[model samples]
Target: MKIEVNMTETKSNDSETITTTQQTSGAKNDSSKGPESIYTVPLLKLIKEAQQQHGLRHGDYQRYRTYCSSRLHRLRKVLHFPQGDRKGFKKREVTLDNLKDEKFVYLPLIQAERAWAYAMQLKQESNTEPRKKFHLVARLRKAVSHTIHLEYICQSPLCDARTKLEAQAYSAWMQGTLFFELQEWKQASEKLVLSQTIYEKLASALNEDEQILYKQRVEELNPNLRYCAYNIGDSSAQQDLLNMRSKGGKSELDALIAQTREKQAASLLEVTWRGRTVPVRLEKIRVFLLAYQGLDASLGKANDCDAKLSAYETILLDCKEAIQSLKEDLAAVAKTKVDLQSSQLGSQQYLLSYLTFLRATLTIDRNLVMVDVFQKNFAAYQSGESKKVAKPQEGVKLYEAMVQLSGELQQLQGMENDKKFQNDLELLTKVFKAFRCYYMALTCQGNRQWAEALALYQRAETYINQSEGKKLGDSEFTKYSRVGQDLAHLRSLVNSGKCAAHAQNILGVEDINAAMSGLSVRSKKVYAAPDLQIWRLAVYKLILYM
Candidate 1:
């Protein structure tokens, strides 16, 4: 007998695993043997079997898979970061797929199967009600049979006495319960005498918590009693079957002979065909023959699907490892570089290569390495490329790179918090504002809308609110106020433009204002927009003439 571990594909993915199963022809492989060997099978085959056994439709399987997938991923995240508040991890399900990574998935699975078996075993005698439709019956049947046969020698004797032992066990359990409730040991002992084993085996194969419960139950009833009055069987029955298989003879023919003789002894003509049957350890042949025919039909088609999935998993691992190695190389280059000109140049070029690798890693496979790299580099606000930039008269080319980098960053999507770009923009903004103001004052000293130029200069100061944050200098305020003097000089330029006594000394005040204002009006007429671009071009022209 074999057990089925029914699980969905969503559960498979959440646990970051894949599973498949195949039935090999011989006596026949048990379906229950699959959970441990499913990784060798196709992921789809297990999913397909879950559908047939449970009669789940494609949509139902898909929903189950989705639910399982959601739980698997959410639990993995919570387990990895357990210090947080996702209490939902406590309620997550266990499945064979995630069992590989889980602390001990099989323990709970085996426990459930054992409980189901014990329940059915107790029902075999005249005293207990039996359960049907338990999911773990096949698993418990197979594992328990193997365990029992390992310690036994004569199969038929132990197998025959198995029921009496179970009846005794059940009697002891009921008698103990009755004595506690009724305060009568005689009635309890009569029930106890029906117990098959003086003591039942503790369910040690179960999980720790369940085993504790089993230990407590058995101790309450079976203290100081011998369990094996009859001899326990051994694997001679199993070894004979193995020998028959090697000799190309029917392994289950012996079971058929015994079953027929028993029917003859009981008078087969009077037998009730529909009577409730007891749970028995069947030959592998009997189990396969009893299994639904659909299992055989499905086996042929699913075997190849499992093989392909195994190949795919291997490829996915190879790609992940290759991408990780590329990142390690890029990190190494960033460290231990000494000469700024040569080493920094190499690093700048390497960054471009790293970006290419990162984008490929992301888009080709949708891995997220680049997102982290982008956030870190852009946030730190460093222009490591400056060390390799062409040295110019002072820092002209360096300033140009800063401006260019600013323009590039501003254009990048989802970079609203690019602190470095904001810093550069703030500095460059002031320089342009001061230069703009002086140009306007020199070219349009007595102009009517020198008011507009002064306003533009004042507005440019807003970008400086963050300069204190960058902590450029202790005299940062004084440096910013120097820009205010350009505004004051513009005011004096306007006052002097109208007064000859203020200029050489303001002699022809009205004419000076008229001439300067007329020149400004003429320039605005030539340019069309009354803005800085037009004013700056005009001021540059006046400077050339001077």
Candidate 2:
């Protein structure tokens, strides 16, 4: 077998170029050259030629690196050379005699190949043992150094360009990869941009076959660049990268960006109160406002409200800590005898009270919704339908919570000066009172206590009527008035003895003559036309006896 190798080098002030030509002649059964022939053929050339012919599969970079490293190690062993440790051969041990030999020129390339493989392996394992990350970084640096040295030795114009670009691009890519793993997003983004630029330029100047090779390389770099862009909040760049084509249509980067935006929107709040923006530095107030908004948003979704309620409860805990700190600051201000009327402490107190009111309102609203859900479920279950029903006691607990929160809102200090706050508080108080009465009536009705149910219904009606006269707007007044009328009718039904009469099935008995025999003609007419409570009660007595 005979092999011929040619090297050409060109140098200009603007650019350094290299070119190489090689020919190989050997039979498939030619084994006389032995393992030493592996070094004579450049590992990169073998990989690139295989890839161009579609002999190498996609994503086989690590596999090829490993194979080449093993072949080079076997070759060194065949030649009675020392098998280096995992970190590569010691620099001092490589003699001048070795450097003078042609085969030794490939040693650095082989070392670089093994180093990159080791770095990638360490990277995968570093998540569990974070200390390994530093070692991985060191290995990548070593790989870069070996590749740079190989570039110096293989100075053919084409070979130089290829090796130089490969070394630089791989170094930038690996550095970016390391920074990304470490969560240094800004640095990762910068390095990845550099790698992408170099690959693009190199691809543009190459033949179609070479361009396809670099195109795949550039494609692999896109996702990491997009990921770094997203983490560093570069929305424009992230979008541009996501819009680029990969194996198919839009990239998963778009989905990732959408998900991140959704989470931010859910947890974020921008509050402007009394013509002033709330600064985000107040962590507790910010969190409280976020939860407040979250609760409002959750109200439209039936099944999701419970999770939002839990989040609001957690925010309240943060509020407690903030409130205590403010109280301490207020006490210090008080000892100094500062003007209490226009002081920052006064403002803090007012803000705290407002937050407390907001928290209370959200709690009341959540409990009301819970009570309604429970009622609907219970009704469904009672109609002999298969439905998931919450325990009736859960509704009772929610009702009690609503009442407690309403009371707390009413007692909050500094609300008197805020007309809008005062009006809302008064209206909510009336509404909660009505709710309490209505639930109590239901409890009494369930226990068959007609008298107690009637009394509670009347109280509820009274509360609704009172709310209408409390300067409530026309819309609120109209709504409350209608509710009051409904309650009034219900109370009358319980008070007229119709409930007892209906329970015994006496209202519409078929034997009307017998049913009304004990009643006067006038009472029979009252039974026929019972418009008022007195008439209904007279008819009920007559029917009960018959």
Candidate 3:
């Protein structure tokens, strides 16, 4: 038995009235009866039929979609009022003009429901077809527009206080949800906030059951709102959302809040660049966050050095893209504004360079780790003793790349003028050069080039000494003092290499002893076997010379 129920609501200044008219296939219902008495049983029966026809399995999106479409059709048939001759009217020919002329009171509400159903279906399809999802979002927006028009133009106080506001809030919330699915975070946050406000105001007018539903809706909106706020870097809004207590204790929410707080604190540390407050760049912040997260993930894959390298490379690429984006944004602003403050621009450029520096530093660290691994493996391959084996070429390439980046950073305007930046540049310069020389010395020593190895070690020692002079504090002074001791030990190695070479040649005892005396007096600490070998060779050479 099919029944059509039509409801029209009218509002006066003081009161609201709803009039229902019903048409049934079997019999005409009483005209004065409310919709609950006449339509509830039929609607429930239709829903039950739909559930039976399409199994109620959890992931059956198609079944759910069919149910929604069937329900929408039944709802349209009930609320639809005939305005013109049905003989010429086609269902597919319905337009906004036709809807207006027919004065279909529930048109917007039905359209919103239909669009919402399609949106849900699209969402369940996964992220493969973004264009289709975006099209659905546009349809949802149109539904929102219709709901807004109904709120203003519909004269029914029954519609105004309850139906109209509910439609508006739901439409806004759906729009926000669609925007979030599209990854339009800023718009999503704004729309969600609007929806939340409307729901809060509408809560007061609802009955106890409806009010409970409204509260649930508001609570459901909070996580999405917080997600959008976080992506858009609206820390205050995020914090507010985090402070909201959930009815059920959510461990995930607590963990997410704690993680966000950590990121916020870390981002805050980089907020000030070169003693000047720079405007927060969400893109840059995102890059930093991704880099840190990628590094953490890569750490877990310790057995896969190539994977770690790829991860670091990806981060470097992202950082470079972010730097380019910043430059373009700055250029666009410069073209329109005449009194452009250069300090802010300089600070932004410095920040970009600093990020690049960090990536390069990471690259250097990876290279050093590889070098250590190679050295260990090489030493293990050759019994337990170190050998003059070929060094990894990647170490040299990475060091050269780092030097190039540091040079570019130093060449930036005002880099030399900023004392802190200058110090940092100089320190990096010394460190890279020292490492390069040390590696070259090892390579030359492996190749049995005593003279070349001695020269490279001397150059490395000179860089270390220069680095020591740039120490800023007592701790740094002590740190460099240890570096100086390491340099002295490297000098002993150089002496030993020279002694080994001299032993093969005809050298006087006086010259051999003089070198040994110089090495012994430089450090009282015992040298490694290589150094001892050189000393013994020197003594042998001295005996031969004698």
Candidate 4:
């Protein structure tokens, strides 16, 4: 048998200085050509070395030395394995005979006239295979190491190929939107255009829900294209007001205002998707656009426009407040748990298990990534930007929520009346393996990460549609809306734009979401209709963040 001496095994503390190197095959280098690796020592050298190391004719000392050397060689070969041997290479096993076959075994060599082999041979029942005799403990340890590595590789393959791509796309989209808001027309236009392109690429790489998110985000941006037209109107309105033209006007400006209103009304805000139109409010800029054209030129007309703008602003503010309040109402519902009986638990457990296994196999952290991604794609949501603005802390980063089901499953596993629960658990394990990829897409869209977010969301939403469908009733819808609205508001306010000083208890919402997410079908249906406004107000009431 041949032995391969990998000299790269550096002693633990001396990991830097020492490294193993295998002697080249069939080569005879100079003995001192930098530390030669000796393996299967030549007969002459082996004798000479043994003689030098020990008085072969003497006591137990020689036997001890031989055993120690042999054992050390074996241990080193076993534990300090080289990397990436998916099919591992084997080492030459030492062949020696006993000098005394009674309490001990010994080498046939005179050096160890009284060596023990029993102690060296691994212990096992006589029926155990020789390989099996080699401790399962060792195999288990190796398996654990391999499992951990596999887990890590399986967990985030998307992040490897595409984290930066999606993040950049989303960041670009967000920048476009921010510029649009700040009225940086040229830059905003360029950014939105870029965002659209990136989103297209992302969409192709994404799943169904992700595709939906891309559509939504694109829709959100579409309406904003008219932002430039609105800004132009704003400039005119401000100019007119600053000039106090109304005090003297009613004459020339009146005609201009009428023309402007006609054009502005004629060119209303509309977004087209799949050849279908979705209406959006351009009210924010409509009045300005109309006023700029001088349709309402008199002081009375200016006053009317002013009154309308003020009223609209108040309405928008009220909506914001209502949305905020809705968020709180949903959060409270999430915090309240509604348990399922054994029968109900079985189905949900099955769903959760299936989703979990699907997630694991797909290699996503959680299914929420799909939702996040889809929202971003649709421009219904954006990803997180900074520390001040919190993002969705669901499935992608981890499947903490899904993983919790394990505890419930374990409890079921021990119960006599949990046959259905047990079955569901098994099903869960199978499907959950395929869900991670979906989760990744969802996360990519959340917290301002649109590209990946959109993709992830698509996959996850598709999963749910396939799995749960319209059964996701008011409770489910409410739960999702609450979290999304809260997140959107929080993010908007982070840079002190809109929705400033949003909810402070991020985890509180998360806890509620998780709890509500777990409620049984009947229990969920049984629960009171959730109120998001009340929830947001509750969060506001308790929150201390300025």
Q: Rate the local accuracy (lDDT) of all candidates.
A: 0.35, 0.57, 0.56, 0.39
Model 2, range 427-452, lDDT digits (tens) per residue? 75666676567667666666766666
RMSD of each: 33.7, 14.1, 16.3, 36.1
lDDT order of candidates, top first: 2, 3, 4, 1
Better of 2 and 4 by TM-score: 2
Write one digit per residue (lDDT tens) for candidate 3, span 1-546.
222333443445212122222222121455454332211111112333454566433445456556656665665666464333556864442343333222244455445555655665665563687667666777567656655654443433222244455555665776786787678989988889998988787677667865765676677778777878888887677645544422232544554555555565455544544456555464555545444554664556445666566656655666666667777876886799766455544655666655655555566656655655665665565575655553535445656676776677667654557666656666766766776776676677667666676677678767767765454342312323333344455556545655554454333344456557668655765433467556866678778558
> Model 2, residue 238: displacement in angstroms?
12
Q: Show where candidate 4 strays beyond 4 Å.
A: 1-158, 229-546
Query: By how many angstroms RMSD does model 4 differ from the true structure?
Result: 36.1
**Residue-level lDDT tens digits of model 1 in 104-177:** 22222223223433433332331332333232244334434332322122122212233334333433453333
Tens digit per residue, CA lDDT, model 4, 1-546: 222334456667443222221122223343222232222212223333454455433433435456545744454445442233569765422121210111111111211211212212222232355664345334333323332332232223212334334434444554554455345877877867776776667667778855766665554554344444344555544444323333333333443433445455557554332233444233423334234234224323534434434433433343344334434543565589655455433332332333232223222222343434433543433433322432344333344444444335445322335455444444343233224444454344335444444444444444333333122132212323333223333322222321121222343455467678778966654334357546865776566355
- TM-score preference between candidates 1 and 4, better one: 4
Question: TM-scores of all models?
Answer: 0.15, 0.45, 0.42, 0.18
Q: What is the lDDT of candidate 2?
A: 0.57
lDDT of 4 at 416: 38
Best candidate, lDDT: 2
Candidate 1 lands at a TM-score of 0.15
TM-score of 3: 0.42
